[model samples]
Target: MTHDPRTALLSAALDAAARGWHVFPLRPGTKRPALHGADRCRTTGDCAGGHLKWQERATVDPHRITLCWQTSPANIGLATGPSGLVVVDLDVPKNQDNSNSSADTPDGATTFKALCERTGHPVPTTHRVRTASGGHHLYFTAPAGIRLGNTAGTLAPLVDTRAWGGYVVAAGSLTPGGSYETVHDTAPAPLPGWLLELLQPAPARPVVPLRLPAVNGSRAALAALEAECAVVAAAPEKQGNITLNRCTFKVGRFVAWGDLPRHVAENAFQAAGEARGLTAAECRSTIRSALDSSLRKVRPRETA
Candidate 1:
């Protein structure tokens, strides 16, 4: 007998809810959240008080899961924080260039293994999910009395963690690339003490105002560059790289117009990002890539 796709998806959602995971619906065949974002809120239904983000709205209720999936074949989204989980997302390299054009360039799993070895710890066996992109998500129970946030490239290259404000596609969910499947069907183990030490958030630091070097640029351009640099310098910990990328991209039009020299902006933002505790390498890569993308898409000066 041919199985109904909606039934299968509903089953996936219910199964996740059964595990005490706060579950939500992902867009069918995609990883993106299916719920309307804050901008689309109409102050109705779930938004009666205010707009609730997907993470806040995620529920472990089987009835809600069934109702949601009964309407469409939506994929399953698991809110790691509400579920008391910290998922280490080990991603694969995107292309040959990112892989350093070397056959030996380690993927996320390999790098994580090396990290484990260096720390003199065995790889923790826990609930594991294989992503559609040929990557792995190692699930661990979060330590009590401690709240952790998401991280990017903090553990290692291609290693990211999903915690508060982040979610992961649960096992049995389907994406265009393939299905997210359970590889290790076991209860998630408590986070390893050593790994917890590595993931523990640093004490909050006060953000200092940035001082920019004078550069040859239009007055407006200079002001804009300085403003964006301050935003980078004051970015919250664990969020510096994204803030730097966004702020740098916003200022890239000045470089394209020759009002701000590319190197001047690059150097200034690099310093600001580093001051915010981002690694030098992470800042450099994010700045260059954002600038390149912005520069390519910028309209001609005369058009502006």
Candidate 2:
């Protein structure tokens, strides 16, 4: 006897729910509904097949359904639990030359492996979804109790289990290739220890907001310099310099440094740093430190 895909999917979801797993459908292109109950469908159109009912039934133990997906109803689902799932969106860098590639590079798989090792987690089941940009969504789940959104702006690697496809292995939820997965069964792995600490399931300490110093000429100069420093601090492989230069140019225009003398440019840079929260003295000191270290290494072998 042939099994219906919809029935099969619902049964799987219900089974998972029985085992304390939260179930959500993973149909793409369906409108998300406003209903809060698990028995109600959260989408409409071809992707809406029996999802509402599944959700309503699952809601009986809302925290038990891990996730659910329907291909005919257009690929969608729901996530219910104490800690939502973690999703890593991967994209290919524009600068990288991938003209001759057909599958995820070695580096990509290696990165995924490293993340799995770091998180002490195993790769759960995987899925391929039709994405908005005509790309494929590769899904993986981590163990329970893992936090998702806490690593929103982090870069992580992904493994392409598909026979043909590639992905970006950088930080953060926004990837050039596609958006990050919104739900999963387990917490994302290889989560940085610091991030894990921040995402502890307890109420977090209130962060003290720092007050910026008054925006004076000096403060503006300092702010500019601080901005430049931030650019210099980024990874060289990540176009840090270009980004920094763009920010510097924008500051130069804002502070009217374009019409000023060369010395004024320096002052404006310093003032910008101060305006952005760094002290003028600190900005100067950091620049001097970088220069001093560079000079020490390059200066002809000190003539004793």
Off by over 4 Å in 1: 96-102, 204-304
- Clash count, one per candidate: 0, 63
lDDT for residue 108 in candidate 1, whole number 0-100:
85
- In TM-score terms, candidate 1 sits at 0.68
Q: What does candidate 1's lDDT look like per residue over 1-304, in tens digits?
A: 9888899888878888888999998899999999998788998998899999999899988888888899999888999999999999999888745546666556889767866765678888999999999999999999999898888866666789998889999988887789999999999999988777666754444656677987778999999998999888888757777788789999999999889899999999988987887666556666876788689879988896
Question: What TM-score should be assigned to candidate 2?
Answer: 0.33
Top candidate on lDDT is 1
Q: Compared with the true structure, what per-residue lDDT tens digits does model 2 show for residues 1-304?
A: 8755455444544554454434444433233422344454365642266444433432325333323333342222334222132333333333344576645332333444444545555633344333333333334343345534322112232322211111121111222445433233333333344324322333322333323243335555556555554543342432322333344454444234323233444444444333333333433432333333333333232331
Question: Which 10 residues in a row give candidate 1 its minimum summed lDDT?
Answer: 198-207
